[model samples]
Target: MVSINDNFHCNGAYVAGDRTIKCWRYPRSHGSETFVQGVQNSCNPVFMAVAERLGADRFYDYMVKFGFTEKTGVDLNGEAVGIIHKKENIGPVELATMSFGQSFQITPLQLLRAASAVVNGGYLITPHFAVKTVDENGNTAKVFEYEKGEQVISEETSAIMRDILESVVSEGTGNKTYIPGYKIGGKTATSEKLPRRSGKYIASFMSFAPADEPQVMCLVLIDEPKGVYYGGTVAGPVMKELLSNILPYMGIERDAEGTEEIFTLMPDVNGMNLKDAEKILKQNGLDVQIRGQGETVYGQFPPADEKINAGTKAIIYIK
Candidate 1:
């Protein structure tokens, strides 16, 4: 989250129409990251450190204010309140994962519910895909009767938070989600749920921007991306592609003037070495990771073929 906010700090929310309805419960903190830094980096450790201060009960209170415990009651059936165990019972690992958006399972609606509060004017909103529903032999009514959730955080907090979110897309974990000149903010997350042998991963990216007011927000989830599965790798790129096309279609103007500079990127070096090819890649704005303490480069992802913005995750099969 720190990573994302840093990039977005350059652009905040854009205002839109009033919430479907108003009245509400809604919903961060200290560190080297500063508010925007923590958000831009999506620093789970930082967010967890803050959540610890907020404590389990306070965190749960924020959850409640966001309406996580209640059913959203959208027009369609099948909706579930996400699971949140007793704060006292929640352990460090569990809390850490939740802080970074893992461990707990939430229906898409539940996820959006929390996100609504984060970017939707400091108020949680019940979402609906349909514009309106026709009444029984009469007029059409708005599909969602927006009941304001709660004001969990201060407006000042919300404003800074929006700026922080923008940093995510601008220069953080969510850089892949940037759309030329538009301001974007949100998070990208990856989960390790299966055995290592299975070699599968879940990558997800979520964003809301034009921070003055958000006209569009989206989340992309890939269950088991076969190649380069981190959210920053698989999901972030996909979100960027979609946003680049959709933002304009939605008539959302770019905050900055258009750009023509195209970046010529270098290769990925995830499981590479401090020496050899890994060093070469780093010279071009790329980064590296090794499996063992061993210094030799091994296999790598993005496999020296795909064209992408530099710094895309490329895990190596280290020696």
Candidate 2:
């Protein structure tokens, strides 16, 4: 969470009215963080300070340069162009909010395309549906092709960004989304609904595998989920689940070597009878412990669809 004191005087005030921007942080993290760590912790103050330094003109130029203001022109139907506030009206407050993904809105596809460019050596390749085609006799036809677009950022900038993004998965809020044997990099984001007073959120995570040379960029967004809504908690696992299957299927080898056990998604045992839930848990190689003397389960720790190490004890609460 940011207080008025967190403002850096490099350019602007950290004002969002009387409301404080509550941010979640790790317990072991010191009160202050570096720029890279800011990416890891998802600190609003750090980005705000950056936006303050960049000011409105440079920030708007970067955004427009990244294709935030125009349609991606992908060969897809119904593509929605993203929205950006006018440069003249973007004052300190507006700039601060926009820096951390508020005030202006971008479509997921747009963000994904831009992200792909960020990691794919700065070339924004148009996304297509097919990678390759096979004929009846197993002869491979040419896969879909897209025009190689212009470079939006420098290779050095992309490399630096990739390293920072990799740090996110290795040591930051995205740690849960890490795969054991692959180099993964990405960012996690949770945006509050417009007007900021509404308690609803849009949780999202964007990832690319084998960070040294990204092959694919995966984007996951969850809207208004129940219980916890942090991007790391909600959207991170969804990305992990997808890549866990996709990486292996695409013949991407695992690079992790150790005794680390494979993780599986926690099953939905809530509202099930105790007998049935226990049976299902056991079938999935999980040890179950009932927390109350009741026949019906009310909840389960680790929650449904979340990845947990195999054989971890699942605590099922009953009432």
Candidate 3:
């Protein structure tokens, strides 16, 4: 088990060989913080230091074990095996950059699979679409199964990671995705596109609901968002919107008490005046997103009578 009290210092940047790796919160030093705090803060120096302790060989081994260097063998064609630095070529700088997810490439599915293993008791599961085929009268015709690979981490370690990740949604950068009465765990990412300093980024958020025992997982990536491109800002809300609808449909009841969110049925605003539609939606505790410049609302999304969490954005189209 990892020690929560293990301390790491972040003095804006970490020096590795001839390179200096700066924290995302550059110029603002976090003098010292425990491992949990470091994770909550998304402090780069803490991860860099941890990678230093693991050394290149051990770190690379973990990467390989996590299925980073190979294709996941998913039930899809033309799946790409992502790139990673060769063990021998990984110097101090390379290790540091890779420690916090850089200097390498992996598909979104690959990352999701690895994340599943981390939270689902460490068993690497093969992802597939079909579960079973049915015959004419809805009778089962054939069953399909996928492999669950060897355990890559101890159950105890997996539990710890789950708790840490849960806190990430509750109190860290991922807090934007948290929904009341639902236990959610997630991580936000803002990946710089190739040809560094190009002012382009992919904002993404990976999340699982009912964090204590995940039933559904989602990975949302917003490619080159127009503005406010931080993952938490751009993708977290999308994940929240998705899970709000999905969890209940899956029959997963909210387990917590005293903090249930207020949900409302979307109202029909079609053919209504824009001001009247806005007033009606606001009365229902919903927000509005107009799609056109016209004053009359010709259409509405979540169209009418659909139940959604309060504060959800209702889109209205005009002609």
Candidate 4:
């Protein structure tokens, strides 16, 4: 892993189309970022450098170690085993591309199984559709047996990875999927389909919540989405919605308080004192920003009763 972050000039060493291979740091123009930031931002070049160092042999070994080379051995029948490239076909370029999760193909089920091991302390788990079996008379018959597979990654490595993944949600590309009260750690992937499939895209986000104590893992994938097919934009919203509903139903207590409410309507702050307006906005989970220097509020952008999502900023003008 990168111990530090700095500028990395690709210089067309690994070119795709007309542009040099590099990470696109969105919203910001240009600067250096930390290693954790790279993971949070889903920086490709940062991972590509690591892949180049690992080379084909070690990289392939890690893939096998993650159970990517074989079936997940789930209880469901007809489970699809993902495909990995042959050893001979894994060149430097292929390895670099695969490092950021491209080129090779894997099923959502396979990914979930591997990801579970990564967060569950390195033990490859068999996903089951049924927890317990029922008899014809609605009596309990048998509970599903679970086998703890060998550790694919070390405990220390898993902990580090969990921390890094958590940053992805809290500080990185997956920030859009973050829920206020939950500690979510995840990665977003935007995979391009082959030309044979008419160059479509699959936007995906995979996450586990309460990083220190993971209760559940979820994956959301949108195939061939129209307009803005980014994992953080499309699939991230879906995962956020699912987690928002399911986490509470599971009776998992939130890590933070006062996060259960959803703010859809912007409250009227006009004609009220600045302090009172700010207080009301805070109560509704909106951040207050003031324009002009007066104490009494004059106007507010988004106005009154406008539809807005939670976590949106409210700008109030005071006279």
lDDT of 4: 0.79
State candidate 3's TM-score: 0.81
The per-model lDDT (C-alpha) reads 0.64, 0.80, 0.87, 0.79
| lDDT per residue (tens digit) for residues 1-319 in model 1 | 1322332211111111231111011112123445456566665555555655566667767767777677766767776666766667666555544565655656767776677677766776666667668888878765645566667666766776677778788888888887766778878777765463477778888888675678788889899888777787789888888888888698886643543233434465544454766667666556555555566666665677564446665455655
lDDT at position 137, candidate 1: 85
Tens digits of lDDT, candidate 2, 1-319: 2332343321122444344433344323234666777778777767877776787899998888778898888778988987899889887778878878887889988899889888887887666777789999988877766778889887987898888899899899898899877889999998887767688899999999888888878888999877888899899989989988988798887754611356667899999999999998988788788898989999998799887766889999998
Candidate 3, 177-287: lDDT as tens digits: 988778899888888889887888899999987788988899999999887888888999999999989998999876546123555678998999999999999898887
Give the better candidate number (2 or 4) by TM-score: 4
Which is superior by TM-score, 1 or 3? 3
Q: How high is the lDDT of residue 202 in model 2?
A: 92
TM-score of 2: 0.73
| Poorest 10 consecutive residues by lDDT, candidate 4 | 9-18
User: What TM-score does each of the candidates earn?
Assistant: 0.64, 0.73, 0.81, 0.74
Ordered list by lDDT, greatest first: 3, 2, 4, 1
Across 1-319, the per-residue lDDT of candidate 4 in tens digits comes to: 3454444433223453344554544433224456676677677777777777678898998888888888888777787778899988887777877888988988888898889889888988877778788999999999977778889888877888899899889888898888876788899988888863476899999999778778899999999989897898889889989988888898976653423344468999889999999999988878778999989999997889886656688999988
Task: Name the 10 consecutive residues with the lowest summed lDDT in model 2.
Answer: 4-13
Off by over 4 Å in 2: 1-30, 132-134, 256-319
lDDT of 2 at 118: 88
